[model samples]
Target: MSSRASAPTPPPSSPDTGALPMVQPAPSGSSPQGLALGLSAYVIWGLVLPLYVTALAPAGAVEIVVVRIGFSLLFCLVLLAVLRRLGELREALRTPSRWGATALASGLIAVNWLLYALSVVSGNVLQASLGYFMNPLVNVLLGVLLLGERLRRAQWAAVTLAAVAVLGMTVALGAVPWLSLGLAFSFGLYGLVKKRLPTPGHPVTGMTAETLVLTPVFVVGTVLLHGAGQLTTLTEGAGHFWLMAASGVLTAGPLILFSAAARHLSLTTLGLMQYVAPLGQFLVAVLVLGEHMAPARWAGFALIWASLALFTLDQARQARLRRRARRALTGSQAHA
Candidate 1:
């Protein structure tokens, strides 16, 4: 999942969505502590996660996803109890509308996790990286389509460039990049649903509610897998079992770090840092995994990178303009 920032008060950062709640503006400057936390989180998400997924060898993607959800719920419950915030989880469950929304978000994130796990296990980490790289643009497009948000000229141009890049890849590969698109759209929609939540509970509480909503289904599925002798957790040896169990901490730890980072860094800094995960994935795919990138594929990635450049430049420019306006207003008031 990617860490994203929004206008005004950011939402609480979720494990999957990573958006800070929109209750207050983030700090305008970056602190060393925030940078360290943000970098650690992104690195783990980008570099460590694929390796971790690969390490879960004999286990299939479905089984891995099931275990991840089960363990993640346990982790969230422990976190809530320690923080004395179990009441928040209960309140969310008590409200029908909140529960329903959490359920929908739960489903979306489950799909995202399954897809990501499948990609990593199948050695398609490059495509997974591309999907995340495209995610911010996807968010922008979704905002325009679903939220009636307007895109500035540069943003429109950047989106058009991304579209062309996708078209080029499709033509070169002789098929759609379904894995890439699937990851992008699934997580994008997950973020959208979280944004539309009725109350926007604390990230940990929200995660608990989401996992609680899905726990029964996953538990039943786990039992069925074990009945068929497909479950690998116990049979995979103590090492693998422990690794599988560690999924919960891996899932929630980075998110908490990211949420803390958001409190100390500006959105612009966070926006730039968000790319660290995808870039790490890309490096891992090429350098570590030795995935061959054909000339056409390289060209496509170049175009996408160029599009991101335009998008980032435009955002920085807009932020500068806003800051200047604010400064001018302050100066005029002081003179009066």
Candidate 2:
């Protein structure tokens, strides 16, 4: 599909009282390319598990995030220049509230990343993958609670299945898989926070602000370490340096993909497809990386998948019903 010259006017920062209710702009229709790009972003993210574990082992999680965020900011600068979105960048920054909310998102995301990286490096990759598997259900709960979205009969059944799945996993493990759960919940909440924020020029602008929130700690931490000759950059291993740079680019690239994809796909479809990352991550963790799993663990994963299938089917049904309702309303108005 051809790109529109200008994006729709964004959502207002604050809603008014006793006036017309505000609506956030919906994504473009049937943008296959955008969906594909979004999936690809997660796909890249999913497939990089082993690399992240290996790359981050030497330096540590905080250091990795420091490098990732700083370099990612640089990467975004270059991309912004290439896309000629500097004007957009300027606007996003000018809106102090946008940047402030973005800074909050950044803090949330940083916590999520730290949890995930720690999980991966500490041989809990499989568990981390499981947390992501459960995340969609969490999002659904958020929709109901936070967005006032409702579920139909099938949707409710899906929720029940997801609960059972999480229960099964907890039972099988003899302990809650907290690392995975923490990552899932934190990241899902990050999305929610970002969702509530006014639309900025680019999705990454939030990440920029997020990074800014931690910049002082990140900078001072790295410097203090470097002063003691503890910085990984001093290792003189070209491979480590390259991975550090790649991490920065990798961090921002898929976000760019998803943002572009967001321009084209409906929110529901995008939300559903967001699972691709975890699926890819799960496969890589189990098959390629050879993360150990017991039969019970397998059972847990199976239940989770079963729950997701139920949820996904329900979502499809709702979409169909919505479409039919829309058509009926149009037809009735035409006859009148």
Q: Per-model C-alpha lDDT, please?
A: 0.81, 0.65
Clashes of 2: 1
Measured by TM-score, how close is model 1 to the native structure? 0.93
lDDT of 1 by residue, 83-183 (tens): 99988877877878887887888888888888889888999998889888888788888887887667777888888998998999999989788888898
Off by over 4 Å in 2: 1-36, 144-150, 199-201, 227-229, 263-269
Pick the lDDT winner.
1
Model 2: per-residue Cα lDDT at residue 191: 63
**For model 2, the run of ten residues with the poorest summed lDDT:** 12-21
Backbone Cα, N, C clashes tallied per candidate: 10, 1
Worst 10 contiguous positions by lDDT, candidate 1: 1-10
